[model samples]
Target: MNNNIKTILITGGAGFIGSNLCEHFLNKGFNVRVLDNFATGHRHNIAPFNNNHNFQLLEGDIRNLKNCHQAVEGVDYVLHQAALGSVPRSINDPITTNDVNVSGFLNMLVASRDAKVKRFVYAASSSTYGDSESLPKVEDVIGKPLSPYAITKYVNELYADIFSKTYGLETIGLRYFNVFGRKQDPTGAYAAVIPKFVIQLMKHESPVINGTGDYSRDFTYIDNVIQMNELAMTTSNQKALNTVYNTAVGDRTNLNELLNYLKEFLAEYDANIGNVEIIHGPNRAGDIPHSLASINKAKILLGYKPTHKIREGLREAVSWYWSNLK
Candidate 1:
């Protein structure tokens, strides 16, 4: 198989991050196949790629081992992005999140092992840091997960580790920190900040600010996330394999700063829209006060470098949401 182009199976490829992955790989000349049930992922996300000869879409759920088997069968690598993702959503129904994020993850790992794929790269979350107050989160040190969603992602790292040792499966996990950008669904209650803010502002509606707006995050962009996934999947370095790396720009932006930033970006679209207000609400359950990532390891090992910071990212995100949603 040519190293530059190989068949890649990306789970949840119709979802926000997954769809981005599909587009990225197809652009790079790789044969891309997607496994998604369209539960949370929308068909419109992948509509642009439907006619591409290099892209193949499979209508299946990761919960089904048969689907996992088929998806893993002719792939050189596996980018396992499928999961039930949101802390609040997990709080509302822990069992369903656990079933999909945990159980379904296992199904993908097992199937990938059986297929003898080159590498298994999956999405891990910064939520894994949980209550850890460390300014810049290091990969080795971690605190107990505060939410079921965090627990699921942390478990993915654990399973990836165990699988590497026990089953000799090569795995790498990318711990995403507040990733946001194009194709993010703002309609969902569990939608991430950037998209939700963009949509609400576009509709001349008030955006909710959970807590005192002091809560901060190392908001990552989608393009950076795609670079991380690709680097993890293609790395040949022994030290880079069988571990997790923090995928972020290593900069922190508080909710207040982010809100103002979004508003400023939106006002460029319509000056009158600048008056949109923010409603303060109580802090959410299982939310960490601050989040920042230490990306020293990923940079050294995988040659991973994040290209976009919050401002540059929000510009792209806000513009896409405006053009696409409105």
Candidate 2:
């Protein structure tokens, strides 16, 4: 694809991951278009690109089919990232989550199909591996969903598969494993563990670890995710067109170890951060005991190579948060 002429539409482009994608593609000189309703995304995230000639922002919601259609107009590729995240949030209000994640995803898919876009790459979730006792999750192997959020993501994959077979629309689903990095929101009920812990430790507050801090996760970095998206969108391999890939670093870190890394990183800014106490609580509902991914498929198919491991990613994330959020 020609970097200067290709137009990529990123839905929810003001959100954490989406905004990073916008920045990356824009810097590469691709015509980057952003569609966001500011429901869960912030305007400040995209403020830096306001003056860029290659950047365009469309304030809209994916729940509306017209908005989706409008966003995809004249676009070459679609990076569908808009969704209501958080398993607990979905449990509390399944209807709203369904309306946005499931229905909104359908709208975007329909729009992309109508537009005849080159590829439709979307954000799937690791939560789809719910209730499965497997240690390392592979693409073809999955269990029943444990939460409404997981169900929505699984339905997205199902819908994308049907679209590919029935309408000949090329699509790829990326099952992300606990992605974290710069611009991740830390002040919300649905805040992810890494950013939340960083915020708490910065304030010298006791960071709570659910379930004895033994539960582990395959923490992926944002740069690695960007690489996966780029490869998914640009790959010419016929076998990789209509399947899912595990977008992860293929390693696990427990909450205890994660906290230790956070403290050590943050202590460079404030010595008191290393002295903060950690509290343990009961395990969260709809949360699995452990999660790891097999990235061999991605490596073989899309040439995916992770740039940062957990500790390295954590250090960079800490520096960003300290510089921006502190």
Candidate 3:
């Protein structure tokens, strides 16, 4: 154990975002430890890091207090990314969603508090905006939760605030938008729109749009998310601690446009992909008509300058999926 190098404990470290964090920190010479139960995350995602001396994996669940505590031991910072995501999944099984996203989050807070970890940065959600009609969602102006998953993530913010105020634990929550990129699984039932669409288009299959194809999102890229997590963990400004920031690109693209972008990118690799038709499905329940983020707060507070917007991020994501999934 090198006393000089900081140790970061990233829960859900085998997932798309978490594994990326592991790679980033390890490359920067930080000791990275992961705690995951392999529920939703894949082993192949973190397999590359297994041989790195600075990387450690603790196969456990955040729902377990003992596991949380063990994970926090000797850790300087904690990035809590372990949560049951997807609004539809939460609607279908609210109980399991609450158990992991809320109960499990509480356990992590308690563990980090007791461990006296320097900072606790978590993966919050843009879904917390709920029914708010705000064009660019500011952090404070949110409406009622639209789904079970939104409630759980909102509860996480409340618990984190309480932990910060009551126990003096430093915490930061990043309300991530539609984040997608390399290593994001496209086969899952709750797969994110971008990766799913990319994979579908690559196979010359028609991608389905949930709504009338007008609903838009602030589709954030994985590298931007990784940057936010790093900033949240390392910022020295006292005012930056114990608050939530919207992790997004401050831009919105509708489902129809999103599909077109996928087609344009994928067609470059396989020209026939451009001819693939699109299928429109019924509007998904618990989905907001439009979602866009005001990243000004994150920019002002954490110095977050998104390196990739929709087209730039999507182009790279499509390339990665074509290479890896093909």
Put down candidate 2 lDDT per residue, 92-137, tens digits, no spaces. 9999999999999999999999999989999999999998888799
Per-residue lDDT value at 114 in model 1: 93
Clashing pairs in 3: none
- Residues 64-84, candidate 1: write the lDDT tens digits: 999999998879999998999
Best by lDDT: 2
Off by more than 4 A, model 3: none
TM per candidate? 0.97, 0.98, 0.99
lDDT against true structure, model 1: 0.91
lDDT of each residue in 77-139, candidate 3, tens digit only: 999999999999999999999999999999999999999999999999998999999788999
Report clash pairs, candidate 2.
none
lDDT of each: 0.91, 0.95, 0.93
Question: Candidate 3 local accuracy as lDDT?
Answer: 0.93
By lDDT, the better pick of 1 and 2 is 2
Runs of candidate 2 with Cα error greater than 4 angstroms are 1-4
